[model samples]
Target: PKDQRKFGYAIVGLGNYALHQILPAFAECRYARLTALVSGDPAKARRIGAEYGIGPGHIYSYENFDSIARDPEVDAVYILLPTALHSAMTVRAFKAGKHVLCETPMATSVGDCQLMLAASKRARKYLMLGYRCHFDPLTLKAVAMLNGGAVGARQVVTTDNSDINVPLSEVAHSWRFDRSLSGGGSLINLGLYGVNGTRYLLDEDPVQVQACILPNKNPLFSSVEDTVAWTLLYKSGAVAHGSSSYTIKDASTFRVLGDKGGLLMDPATSYWANRVSLISGDATQSWGTPQFTLPALNQFSAELDYLAECVARQQPPVRASGQEGLQDMRLITAMYESAHTGQPVNT
Candidate 1:
């Protein structure tokens, strides 16, 4: 018998991530299922829908997206479009009387984020941010350890999220390089992992933000930045340093330090496997590094199930709420401001 209790999700984009990660994750989702697909390309939509057992009637284009309001099977819409389009799509989903699960960096501007939140409130629909790490078992384990004094007193965090270089032709054609579509470049797209991950681990918002654009003379970055670095100051005297680049092959890694000891995670925010090690020392023992082996959980599936559970219970998402996404955009905006003015901005 089918689990009719599962929430139905209408994925609103057919991008690479949506097809590769989000769609596949549905198979592992305990509380959610793919009920519909929205894509501008009819061929892709039909093919994907057929593969997922979604009939042509459930396949929608951007032009007919609002008609989903009449679809009882579509209890929620998952917005996986580019950063700038997140706000508008979310608002429309709310108007259609559907819950929303939007991807991170929320929107291009703070005002856009606020608008999405207001729309959700007005429509009385649930809004969840796609901060997948919050629901990952490994990340949750790290957070629990840090909070449990595994690292005595939190002191510092450093993270770098960079990817392999892209050819000039591809870079020029991708929406990620377009300022209007992406808002910025590597910092907004890649560095968000570092920023959001640090904040979640520490459970504290930065008080001040300072940033600068790194030297990248490539013509590929003309429309947006290629590399950037930022520093965040916490009220507890804690500090975080982060950097990201589109031209660098650096791994997505973060190192957390405390008075007693610290932990380092290489490939921390990767979609696949990750590594974490604890470094602690005492007078008798120089230092001991222990590796942690935790249960593997699909990040996308965990987050989707989490939001579905929240909606099933008619409760707000506690971990990755819309407000959490708004705060990240606010901090990102401040980072941009700081990088432009060469002065620290109060957040």
Candidate 2:
């Protein structure tokens, strides 16, 4: 028998990511539903809410967000706000007696991540980070293959997560271009996948970080780095190389090479259609390239159900918890520091 109860989620911030990805995902989630909508725009919220069968009473503005505390239907809040607002919104949600699922780069800094963790502890509610890749079928398969010694002991990893096309007009008005709102540009916005991805696949943290932010001549990138490249060195004698850029054509992929052979994936972190290739064999025999048939999953929906399942079981989201986000923040902070000092920073 399965738990028939579906947990209700109050979607905070009806931004593009929320509207395009998160909201659509609810339809596929078995244990989660969009019971409420929180947006600053009443008209937009009400219009969208109506489409989702959310009544006007369940639609709330940012000023009235705390009122959700009394809405028994909302068991949790999925925070899709800007990077800087994540910490505050998560804290407020917990204070309102609700579990929280916040998007990645948890907060602008390591300190804010700690604050979120503390608030979740005080509320005794679960705090889950939106590391959707963890639930992604393709990502899980790749992790399993690498860790299962399909490629042998992982020695080197390389990845690039970037979307180079952005009109200057959009950049001028987007909060992502504003440092105060987004924390950082390309790296935090798009590159975080590689930074976090390598760690997940290896099941280990980097011991040292060396990084550099590429220079941009464009005026739009004056406030933030247009591109960044980083290296993560591990104690297991493994090295990971990653890069993210707003000026490069679409490139989202990761390659893992071990002593025996290697695995490669192009378009690896996309919302759909991720493919993988593996080359492995013994020195005494010819190499074997096997084909695999993998099922595709809605990344957003899987992540939503993950938290709902945890809530139903009255347990913490240990797999993608706040601590995971905090660790990434620490690594990111170190990368920035290393970039500034022109030296390898120990993590």
Candidate 3:
């Protein structure tokens, strides 16, 4: 018999992103629904569960997370924990026979990414990365244009993503500023967007990476880099430059240059607003907001629906798989190594 029910998701971690963005997105998802929540704080879990109409029995704590395996309502686990905890939590979800959708920067290190992948494979379950941009309307248009020869062969790419940091004391317990918890600072948090964007735009991985971390005297960033810049060199002689900073005001944009034309995206990765332009010779064309088949489109909901469809059809995720995430982690690790050694590292 064909099961026509929506896939159930247990969202682990009641952090800001999960609470604000991911939780609300469940209302818009057609193929997936939030049936459970895992949090370290029982009070917070109970409050959110009440708001979402989730039963108390489906609420789980960090210590009792494994018990989710016995809950028939949870068919998948969305790992939204801190970066360092991603690997262990993902592995545990896989072992529980639940598909995983982990947030980006997958894990703190390449080794942890490998472990997560291995665990997913061992459990014979799908592991998807939560890369919302891959499902964004403007982003999808850019990808299609690049692949359709709108830009010909991409020659160079540049991106900037930055945001002002919160007070050290405020985030001290959140693990964002901890070196061990976050792996790196601006590079891992903000620059990973550029790294992944470059790869998707070029449709190829870089052959070499050169990076440098700008010195910061701020006490708040003693454990992580306050600002960082990196370059990626591709085999086709294409190059990409990316920068991320904690002290800068909010700015997110990327540009791609090719033989025939160029592409520009201002506020490229924002949740709501993004604009793209195509430049060829003296003429410039603007591609306004993209049209979607659905009545309402939320990036998070789309990604969740995509994962659910993949699970329902017994297919693997192509763009946002664990392997794709591992590739970015490897590149990030190499970039950090190159920055530390003051030398270019081969990918």
Looking at model 2, which ten-residue stretch has the lowest summed lDDT? 281-290
RMSD in order of candidates: 1.9, 2.3, 2.7
Worst 10 residues of 1 by lDDT: 281-290
lDDT of 1: 0.88
Report, for all candidates in order, the number of backbone clashes. Answer: 0, 0, 0
Model 2: how far residue 215 lies from native, Å:
1.2
Per-residue lDDT tens digits for candidate 2, residues 290-343, read 356478899999899999999888889987789999998999889989988999
Q: Would you list the clashing residue pairs of candidate 3?
A: none
Question: For model 3, how does the per-residue alpha-carbon lDDT over 159-272 read when each residue is reduced to its tens digit?
Answer: 999984465557656588888888889999999998999998899999999999998887878898978988999999999998998877787888898988888888788887
Q: Which residue runs does candidate 3 get wrong by more than 4 Å?
A: 1-3, 164-169, 283-296
Evaluate all candidate structures by whole-model CA lDDT and list the values in order.
Answer: 0.88, 0.88, 0.88
Cα lDDT of candidate 2 equals 0.88
